[model samples]
Target chain A: MDTAGATRILAVVTPDSGLVGPGGAPVFMAHSQEEQERLALLLARIMGGVPHDLENGVYIVVKHS
Target chain B: MQNHVLTILLGVVAGTLARLVMLRSDYRHYPSYPHGFVTHISLGFIAALVGAVAVPALAKPDYVAATFLILAAQQFREIRNMERETLARIEQTKLVQRGSDYIEGIAGVFEARNYLVIITALATSGANHLWGWPVALGVAVISLVISHLLMQGECVGDIADVVPGKVHFDRSLLMVGDVVIMNVGLPAFREKVLEEGRGVVLKPRDDDARLTLDSIGQRQAILHDISVILGTKIDEKEMEFMPLAKKNADTGEIGIFLLPNEPDLECLVEIIKKVPVIESSKARPLSSYYGRRAAD
Candidate 1:
């Protein structure tokens, strides 16, 4: 059973500007680090993905396939 | 004709008995429904019948009837395919899936056991045809014992040292004793995992064991077995609590981190030790001269 789901970046929540550029995934801009974390968590829950931190005031919700 | 009847009866009984003894339904193993038991036992009986009749048919100079045993070979091959298909289909629904290597190993075991039954029946009936019932009975017992011994697959305990390891977070990354399993940004998930997760490290005994542990399928099997026994916290929707067994490439040590429903580290170690070494992943690097030469 080879079920490697297509990994897609569902949403990117970032407080810092210029760190993330818009491409395949939609980016959600946040005023603070706490907001960014909160948005990532909410998106992960709703979309059934995992929230991963990029360590530069940025968090991304990735739906692992 | 009377002698052949007696021989076939004894052989089929012995073969069916062997299958019954081996058909154990455990917590981590297959589902042993009544239907499953019936299917396997019937197959065993047929295999035994074919084996038992072969000797008598050859002795009676009925070559065509004897050639029917050759068709049994083709029938037994379908059993392997059947097991593989069933298991592979079941794998899709599992949260902590049994890896392909594990599936292949199990399917192969099923096929091999049928062959063992055939051999037991063949040997027993042959003994009866050549000597007497007393010798045939002894031969059946001996072959069954050999089959039982062969069924004992090698486990992690045989080739590694299993020990409890600390589950901690290196910033956002979840680390089980320096081997980073996965990264998490959700504070909710991080807190739950840190509070409830247990970690165990497997240090390979030697190079061969190291290579075996390196296989991704083997690692998945370890995780799947542990999750099955201990009960995983992860659900279909939530991937955050998914268990992972990550390897430390430098030292050939594996760090397994799982959020068990019951947080018993001791039992976790015991289960880790008992996890069967996946047959396909078992690489014997030290056995070859070139492999030995390469190993420093």
Candidate 2:
């Protein structure tokens, strides 16, 4: 099995656009695909796990079985 | 025959008398100045004048010949003196040049560690030996080669010197990180936002939060945010906030920009202090970095 290719993943971070949140507070929206990856990475780092079958432009939290 | 002899005799007598008068005058007093040439010329002219006046008893041709001989002697003396003076001046200049080179060498070592004076000295020496077209071209080539080698050697030497004491030295001051930030972001934002006659206000998520900028764009935004936070009314239509990468003009502290949020500004300083100074591996001629503007 090609373990290196199978396990290795790359994430590219980019700037997000500003948006109005539910509380009328100015919250930066993760508009760019790069920002989405960054958010996923941040979430995973914080959670201490990676998600299974991650979406294209959403937070991914991977888990080690 | 008697008249010819008399003319020759009188010319010599006149020339000798004039020389004696000059030798007694200021010529002997001011030895430093080229008084010898003045003495010979004045005496030669006086002899010629006196010989012309006394030529009534002597043959005109003999008198003329005598005058010419006196003039020739004067010229010969003057030329010899001039040659000696020229050699002395050259020696003096060489001495001064060597002294200058020594001072420059010491300064280069202390102030600008990436400086070399030997290359300049070698180039000047080479120029002295070489002359027209081929030599001129050769000297130029050699100078450029020497300069490059010197720069490379100095850079390598600096790195070697610094590497051993890297842990002890504060390396952040030497880093061109601010220059990198300026190059990457300032121009882009300056054109897109500032130049386009648009007013944009940036405020931190938390009122107490200090924005730590990694690029010039972020720095500019932070500056704008600071001005707004301070309630400083900047006419965005007329005035644009220029984020200059400089320290406080009043204080000697480096990398401290004029911006709002006192705590954040202090934090930026702390962060910058931690970054290591960047080193250029390749050597380049300083002339290449200089622009062609005559005023500059």
Name the candidate that leads on TM-score: 1
Model 1: pairs clashing at backbone N, Cα or C within 3 Å: A4-A65, A5-A65
lDDT of 2 by residue, B249-279 (tens): 2221123222222323333333333222122
- Which parts of model 1 are misplaced by more than 4 Å? A1-4
- lDDT for B142 in candidate 2 is 54
At residue B172, candidate 2 shows an lDDT of 15
Stretches of model 2 off by over 4 angstroms after superposition: A1-65, B24-296
* Chain A only TM-scores, each candidate in turn: 0.85, 0.39
Question: How accurate locally, in lDDT, is each candidate?
Answer: 0.88, 0.31
In model 2, what lDDT does residue A26 have? 24
